[model samples]
Target: MSEPWTLHPDRALPADPATRDLAREIYAATKDLPLVSMHGHVPVEWFAQDTSFGDPAQLFVVPDHYLTRMLVSQGETLPRLGVGSTADEAVETDPREIWRRFCAGWKHFRGTPTRYWLEHELVEIFGVTQRPSAETADAIYDQVAARIAEPDFRPRALLDRFRIEVIATTDPAWATLDDHAKLAADGYGERVLPTFRPDPLLHPDRPTWREDLERLAAASGVDVSSYDGYLEALRTQRERFVAAGARATDHGHLFADTTPLDDAEARRVFDAALAGTVTAAEAQAFSGHMLFQMAAMSAEDGLVMQLHPGVLRDHASAPFAAFGPDKGYDIPVVTEFTRSLRPVLDAFGHHPRFRMIAFTVDEDVYSRELAPLAGVYPALRLGAPWWFLDAPDAMRRFREAATETAGFSNMSGFVDDTRAFCSIPARHDLARRVDAGYLARLVAEHRLDLDEALDTAVDLAYRLPLAAYERR
Candidate 1:
């Protein structure tokens, strides 16, 4: 007989029973609250078309780098899991075979959060009580495929079922937002929104920097060759995103360096950036200026700004060369936030209307840099542990590090930041559990009261993210 597969009763709870009880209470209170995902990478067209999901493999396996990356590490090729190849000839031949291969490799995720989430999806979402294996693969696949074909399995339906109050999608500045416009026209405006992500346009060091700039110019119908023209183009595009129900601007830079360059210096760097000859320092300066400019735009437009820094995207050159960005090659690098953000903080950190949520890949800076800054700066808030650090351990560490100094108000609850649509509820569940456990520890240690713990738990689970990213 197969080993009895079950999620632990004490999942994400503290080891101590008393703490576990408190954590359980905290989790139970906020577990059913509506999910407010303020930031993510889900395509807007999914809701725009309100289309039915194709298959289990396509819906669950193909688009998620988290699952595919692990499978690839185990020598399972991406093609076997239905990850489409850039080369036209290499697409997976059969979806059923991909499902079988994925099931065969499911054991690799044992004891992982991904494993827990997949199991939850199988059990709770698909009602598949049996464990996934070579034997159960086809049965589970057929069940999910049929379920997805039902009317209630549509994207909007799933959103409503997931108790998601609102979800925001990240898009480039050049994005037409046609799908977002369609969603608003269809009267789903209050449910789904766009976020302005200016990385490709702002990062002068990006591979296709010049081409991207020209594309931005064409998309916005504003000449980008001149500095003044570029500002007009960015303003026009930001207004377009704002009109389409966007509430925030996302900036993912290598670091958090925000200093304004003098016009002459800025113009020189802009010229070099357009010519694709800017140095790393010049690129950094240009990005910094753009961030300050974006902040000014946010102040005017009431769009919250989210600064997610310290991600070394495409750490491996070979896979990036073969597959391009976000093929699970990104790695976290050590980041200096106190000094790096000083320039920006000096300018707008105290502004009443200016709001920025700071996310870090460098965990070491949580207590030392991020907490102290957010504790004092009116404009700053700490984003939840993101990407590499969104796991159970990291979540606990973040609370332990940041809660005392910055407290619950200075933290922006939890944002899943996942492309795996099915994992959304599971990811948020894990966060709620981890936070409950963290607060439970505080209560056990006499650091906080039970009632206050309950309040903090609810804030961490429900209120803070919306307050951080919602329209001002």
Candidate 2:
């Protein structure tokens, strides 16, 4: 009989006998490093409530788009997997049923990072001894459910147990941040910080732009009737986030363009958008201009700017309408940065206090655009493989493509960029192992000494994120 699934200690390392031995040492050195999840979408409400994760499906399947998207590709219905239910689609209410569906589709996640993270969570975190499948679904669910029911498995307790040194939660520009304030009062604010996300405020083409602008006014106590007032309102709200221990601002625009329009053009577009008469071209230009404006704000306030463009949110409309945003349909579009970001980089690339971390799902830009840019700029750093490129082979490919031009210092280490809270350590672990494997090749090739490789591994695993994010 075959044995139940288990995670190998040397998983994700190099394959060669000699290089694999070197990778094992490097991985061992950095495997237990404290995770600094500087960029993620984990909800702040988790810590504020300190509640137990409800069940196995709620904790693992329902909230993880990575899992849901894969299961969806395998012909499973979205609502049946416990996603949002509309009048047209009835969501499954039984957590056990959702678990069964996910287990049955487990084979679909192979060759995906989703599989690796889930396996780590099951074997290392939850102590599950059986492989997930139709036959073992109930047994594994029972194991995970009972484990989370423990007092130490509450959200706050998991933070300590996971050794997550710091985590940043993405919050909208208009959020009241009362939850973050509550976290501060409890002395957990600095450990769990907020990241300012102003995508709605910048994109005039969005249907909710006007409503979100009013929300920014309400939050900032500024009159956002004029373009100047709108900019001031954004700045004031960023101050609120900074006061709450924010160290970065996150932007996910569709395009990487950052050319700024003149004052008159800016006002014209703003006026058109306010009247709901802005054309798609004008809105695209204005969004790019707003990105430049954001860079200017970061330059002044010292908030580390994180820009990840080239994603078409909600690629499939039917599922999106039924389940809403983040339903696992955001697809990557080809993106360019060299010319698109010239305006922002030209203004602040050499600024002493200015910093920006550039991320992309478009891996083609790593060697062609991002690495070459970061190689020279004093203020820019290349972010790790993000979103679609966060898999093991893609990550290794990124190192091979970018490290030659940008080297290790010009990178921002790794950001999990996850919405699932339990996978924080697992994601970081996967990254560490991949980095170790890459660095082992260098040591074996005599490009770097073993001690030097170990130091770089620690930097990639721990130190670099702190510096890239301006974590003092």
Candidate 3:
């Protein structure tokens, strides 16, 4: 049998011996920097409660769409992986069985970022010695379970172990933030922060729109019976997030269009939505207008605006119907930001307090649209490769394509946009290595001095995120 799982120290570095040496130095310098996670989807309750991380399957398999989607593509049912579409659905109940299924299909994740992160978690976090497979699954599961039983394995303790200086968890606009309040009272509010996410309230076409509006009204204590009242409720919720130490607002819309409708038009559309008579086209327009409003509000409030566009959430109906959203069905569609964002960009793109980071899964826009748009706009910067494109090769391509036009300063250092809490360090470590390799190539080519490359590497890994996520 092959040797037990081991990660090479030089993995993800440049291939050439000379360039690889330079990258090694850079990576060594950057590999241990304090983690500053400004944008992510980590569950807030983990740190708020500071509880044990449960079993191996629950930690690594159940909630990870990246793992489940690949297994699903290989013809394994989600239910067999313990991911039933609904609570009442008949599914695998044994965590060991789920672990076996994941381990047996381990080969399917070859060459993917999921493999890189999982291996890091297994080896570095859990002291796992064997590569996952049906044969080794039981042994590894026992090892991980023992580690989870340790007091140091709690979520808050892992934050210290992972060297995370600060992390922002995505929260709905109307969220009570009770968990966040708990963390704040425990004196970790600054380390574990909330991020305002108002996507649901902005999408009036959604089946749950009215229901979400009522929730917003109740949470914000603002009546949403009128269009102006709805706006006030959103603003009020944003203030609540700011009070909870939120540094940013996150939007994952399907389009980048941010054209503002006149107040009359906006009110008319909102009224139509309330009356249940809004057309699909009006709903889309209203969503775009809301984006404009979000940008405007960010300009006033100084919360960094994070815009992620061009995703068709839940592309497959069967799995979605069975397992619900974010079970790896979200797929990327073509996105254009240059023309689509002109309305908002023209207005706030130069505003001193307006700061925006544009993230897209569409690599085509890295050089053509986003880079140039961010290059000239004082308020805009290109975010790191996100979602489907956060892999090593995609990250390298992002630096290559966008750096020419936007340059390094205009890029938001690596934003680890993930929902998996344990994978945070792994994700950042991978980014640092990819960036070290990229900067090493530049140094070897005489395009940059080693000193300059080293400084830039630190910026990409540490300083840039602090600045990017800082209030402008």
Best to worst by lDDT, what's the order? 2, 3, 1
Q: In candidate 3, what are the lDDT values of residues 63-170, reduced to their tens digit?
A: 888898899899988888888745555788899999999999999999999999999999998889899988999999999999998999998998899999999999
- Cand. 1 Cα-lDDT: 0.86
Candidate 1 ranges beyond 4 A from true positions: 1-9, 86-89
Residues 1-472 of candidate 1 have per-residue lDDT tens digits of 7665566767778888888888899889888999999989888888999898888888888887778888888998765677656453376868788888889889998867788789878877888867888988898899999999999999999998899999999898899888888888888998899999889878788888778888789889999888889889999999988888888999888878777888889888888887778999888888988888888888788889999988888887766776777864687778888887787788878777789899998889999999999999999999999887888888888888988899889999999898778889998989988988988888899999999989988898889988998677
Tens-digit lDDT track of model 2 for 1-472: 7787677888888889899999999998988888999999999999989998999999999988889988888898889999978677799999999999999998998889999999999999999888899999999999899998999999889899999999999999999999999999999988999999999889998878889999999999999999999999999999999899999999999999999999999999999998889999999999999999999999888899999999999998887777776674999999999999899999999988789999999888899999999999989999999888999999999999999999999999999999899898999999999999999999999999999999999999999999998743
Q: Is candidate 1 or candidate 3 better by lDDT?
A: 3
lDDT: worst 10-residue window of model 3: 83-92
Q: TM-scores of the models, in the given order?
A: 0.95, 0.98, 0.98
Count the clashes in each prediction.
0, 0, 2
Best by lDDT: 2
lDDT of 2: 0.92
**lDDT of candidates 1 onward, in order:** 0.86, 0.92, 0.92
